[model samples]
Target: MNRFMQALGLSGNSGRGKAELGRMAGASLQETAALYPFALLAAVYVLGTSPLGLLLLAGGFHYAGTLAGDRQSRAGGSRLLLPALTAAAMAAGILAFGLRPAGAAGAAALLAAAVRGLITGRKRLWTGVQIPLPLWGIALSVILYVYIAGSNPPALTPHRTELYVLCMTNLFVLLLRWNTDQVRSASPSYEVDGQTASRIAAVNRRLTWLTLIPIVLIGAWQGFGPLLLRLARWLISLLQSSSIPAEPPKQEESLAAAELRHMAKEEIGGTPLWLTILGYTLLALLSAVIAAGVAVLLYKLLSKWLPERLRLWVRGLLQRFRRLRAIRRAPGEQAEYLDEVERIEGVPPKRWRRRRPDGKRQYAGDDPRQAYRQLIARAMKRGFVFRTSRTPSENGTELETGGRYTDYSPEEVRQLIARYNEDRYGRR
Candidate 1:
């Protein structure tokens, strides 16, 4: 037990362990502080209202505002403000329109947040939003279904279908988010090579095509009219005729036995195939349309007013909250590579050429040759092999020819080689 406990500690020394523990505790506290508002809002939407719920709601809004303020500071953009306003608008929508409309508003707000995260390259923020958005969607669906079912018996079937649609839509949103992340991170820099660009473009096109399946399904449902009901009835009649015993269970049977038998026969035979297809296709199309619209709107907003306003507000907020100084620090991992690239670019071309002790010329000053070599090293780590005799450009050409570096292109390779060749041997 002592060994196990020691193993759990940071280096198993009380002083260092205590400091590490403190840091972990602080991080946990910060995370909880950030998340409590969303939790409270979720509770307000999911659980029945009470005085406590109202208090939580107020606290949640204030906390959300604080987070918005912090996010604005970090991204130099109005990262949080849009979502906060969106939430407020959604709440007002709930009051004015209805729960379903509010749910749509919530979805729009979530999509907007995701779009902002994607545009700003805030992977952590995007991922965090993705996790909760789906949960909230599912919870809202359940709550709405219950509310609708309780209010009117006849509405249950349609409401249930709507709930399924919502769930499917949520799933498609997740898929799109995943695909978008994949596309964005496909290359190391903003200027993706031709191959990487083509790959991303292809994936996006495939996603678009996949979207048509749902649209077609929805259209077919609209065109066909109640095919699911007809199919279900037909299946039920067939089952009743073939499987169910003509005679009722004997009186000697236990209540449990009779109930089980009845349930087995009565439970609507699994969802009709057509209904399943229709639900999925409609939901997918709905989700794709909403996500696409949100992405476009985000692009426009980022292109115009929001980013400047965010930077100003964040700068002011940072000045006021001196304690939140840590949030202002540059993200290390992301900046490190960018800094290296900038450093390489900052070097003068004349300084990049150096004569070796052996009288051979080489590219110096941490040039693109070094970056290309590093890329090769990384590829080796990922199980790619290159012959030592081959020059970096030759290897790059070989890789491109073999279709190995899907994330890079032959032109990019040639550019790197040209730079290297210029440094080694003066351009003719």
Candidate 2:
């Protein structure tokens, strides 16, 4: 783990800034490592029924992705074809086993890797949209299980440790998803500083805790589940019983009312169900009241009795915490402050030469297509229109022959467009 973080430039207080080809490869590898579990879950739980080969293939796929990222980093171009091609091959292999769904998922993963930062309609050379592919895979896995099993698996009791594992796994995946997005979408020139990194860490912790909310809610439901079900049945029975025509009357009361009376007297662990329910409800209410009172008392006591120096120190800590919280909320201020601080501290901002844009959404330093994009932007800026419908070659010829559009040589314009076309479409 330590070695992995170091390799990715994601270790210690200041590792994850200023995107480089090497760092990009390392980050891509980490994302793949995170993805390996998806294959495992599928093998163990997703209807592959424990195919060990999938895991090995997944590892190979990630290794390939890492290599592709590293190559692109060193090569100075936009071709990240290797990772995508590797994924396609994996998909094909999975399909050959007749596991169509798993094969489909692998194909989806391929697209997520391969088409990044490529021309896509209105947005030329745009990064692929980020999606929680693992989450989708999990959902699909469960759906497949349900379809194949004839009936859904038995309702899980809270005692199953795997449920908690799955929930925590869910939290982990979400955090990785967030971090991957953060790393990929950042500008090439951007550097992640200590405070920004800290803020990201804080958000990761918050998200990890966020998953606990649902787990806690689910746990709480266990206590209420039976009662709720009984009440629902009672209500449904009452609604249905009201219209019963041929029912024998018991003491001039309807069947539902009789059922209610019977339920009231029903024994739950040697105590009447109604009495047990009342006792639990009263206990809960009493506990809530006492807890609230204690909280209020603590607040009042702390405000009144805390020493002046301690109070000030606490307030300072709180202010610092608030600043941390505001990092994402008020990023503009944070950005300015960070830059200003870096300048004051005499730390030259570190930068890395990008081989080319890969899965990292950042535009690479020597990216072949970047120059063409600049030309397009400049053409738009000069109050003259380039024909959007025409190919780059056609547009270049039109500009050169038309003779009214440029301060530079018409031949230069033609050559520029030809080069742009060659890089954008002709280059493999």
Candidate 3:
């Protein structure tokens, strides 16, 4: 019994088990926070639709694929192929089960062609292909459910509510993913000073709050209005019309009969084809513009009115809520790494160096020129190559113009060079 308990990680003195549990808990919380909007939508959907098992299965596959892709990306390997294969396989399986054999084969062929087209040419296209895999998987799962439900002759009419929820949730997830990717790409990969990291975190938090507003609005619409339902219906009708048979009606059919048939089709569907397409196009554009404006205005207002202390508190709360600290590397590791890098570059260590009364580090000879040389050496370690014959000002200018340091601003580089020149050759 004791051995079994130990194997199950329930035994006392199991530090490894405890650490693994902590990691799992932290990952779970982070994922929950990241997908909170989708979770709420899923809950609403499951409560109304009663397709919990299918939804869970689809979500599980999607999460697994996404995690695989992210792992590959971090390792600087091909990131999209595995996700694409997983998503496509899941979609094909769902379609095969829910559709006629001919229809399933046709859809699978179409999906294969689309995936190939997306991933064939450029590296940039791989990312575009990978991002939509989860949404496509979820959409296919929903389609399978709707098809199954409609298989019953008495229940031929599709469930509009489930479709609406899927559309809204998919849109929200897409937006959230896009915003996250943008923020992540904008962030510097190298370690930064505390002030820079804090500023970046603040910007990310603000963007996150802005992104949530639209999702909240979507949730409200789901609860109180039929906007999403109507939109879904219109979109479905437009697609159906576009795929209509090219052959014309029989000449024997009376004009009134043909007109009545067309009207009946439109009524049964949702809206006239042209009007539906136009309305949705305009609606999408307007929503995008409004969301952008709202985000900008909210950011401006908060920056102007919110106190720093309150802002810090809010940031801290958000970090704790998301379990970010649990996932972040230890501060000691980061400090040690930075110190080691500085030592390798022949720069004085901040910790062991003597400090003046003004809190500035005192150089060995009490000369700012030597301090400037150390700073130049540090810059060299950061990829700023210096020529032995070049003067300090020339070296600084070359470094500034080279655009090697992606994390530093142009003005910051200019200012640093100016200070170095002033200390080295100008009146002090």
Candidate 4:
């Protein structure tokens, strides 16, 4: 009876554990899902109406979509592709619906949602479906103000509030998952295994290209966007002035003469905006270059004048830094072996053995092979035989060079043979 009761208890515990696991999985899916409606609204309100605002909204969605796609069970594509596709769909929907009559647009939106749902299925629909709601809310407010509430609403308007909300929602989602165990697990491995380290390095190099493109774009825009805009404005002004009829002075002979003078004046007075900006940019770049050159020169001078001890310290520090970088860059067991060698005490080749005066166990001689064996025995607390040689030539004489133990340099062998002969022949 006791055994049966114990088995029954164990079975109940196992069943409860499975039930709890199922509940947690369901909750996590729901949490991943809860933000779709708001995303849908944001999408509808922003695109086509506010160009920059639309871009910001798209960026936020792309970020959130990327995070979501990465977290999803089926990561079938690149982490960035899903988010990008979702943004594209949102943009398309806004352009399609926002430009149409309100009633017609509503039907179109419902149709689009249905079609999208069918094409991508319920999971992917929810994946991209939530972006239109906040967009709709902002669009509704704008459409109402433009058509009904105002006498003359501005043609250019942006749903700044909804854009802000969309950005915040995405930032929050990213932050929420930032602390997840999965993110920690996916981080580049520090103590990598197999080819994983090289793969990670390659991935990082590729991702660096992602950053480089944005940097180049920003650099060009900062250096040239304003210049181009100014040039366009100036060209428009020139055309406008050319189209205007100029009044002739009473003393002037002809209208053509007055027009030609006006043309010449305009030409003389008009500064090339591009050239002006280019000059300033060049000046700024030159100043930066000169400052950098001066700094480098000062550093060289200071290094030259520094105390010898200080220079040595700096050189040592630089070498240590280089060694550290090499260690960081090297692969495999070579690094570990170097680290072990650094940690252990030095045992020079020559002074490899020692013995106690009591001499319970003895060392034959200081030949490295014998010394190494002695050292090992001493380390392991084992006993070993000590052999002494005689035969003045074999032991310590100059002619002992051809002995079987003559692998050592002739001078070293001679020295060892001399010691052997001294000890053996002295007793003889």
Q: What is the C-alpha lDDT of each candidate?
A: 0.48, 0.47, 0.48, 0.42
Clash numbers, per candidate? 1, 2, 0, 18
Worst 10-residue lDDT window for candidate 4 reads 335-344
lDDT of 3 by residue, 269-312 (tens): 66456766776776677667768886664454344357898778
Model 1: lowest-lDDT 10 consecutive positions: 335-344
lDDT tens digits by residue: candidate 1, 21-87? 3333322222232333343344345433332333233333433433343345445654455655565
- Which sections of candidate 1 miss by over 4 Å? 1-71, 74-124, 127-136, 139-165, 185-191, 194-199, 208-212, 215-428
Q: Which predicted model would earn the best TM-score?
A: 2
Instruction: For each candidate, give its TM-score against the true structure.
Output: 0.27, 0.31, 0.28, 0.21
Q: Write the per-residue lDDT of candidate 4 for residues 78-189, one digit (tens) a residue.
A: 4454445544555655554464554244333333333332233214332222323333443444444344223433332233333333333432332223223222245556
Question: Candidate 2 lDDT, tens digit per residue, 1-428?
Answer: 45554453334343342333333433343344344445445555544443336544544454445444444444543544645565576665566445577566655544444333121211321122223443454454444433434444343221133333343354344445455445445634334354565566467657756865665565445433454556545654554445444555578888898888667756432334555565556556655775786565344334536788877886778767766775667656334232100111232345334333452223324544554555454445555575433556665565566554444467666666566557655832
lDDT of 2: 0.47
Clashing pairs in 2: 76-355, 119-125
Ranking the candidates on lDDT from highest down gives: 3, 1, 2, 4
Q: Which has the better TM-score: candidate 2, or candidate 3? A: 2
Error of 4 at 200 (Å): 25
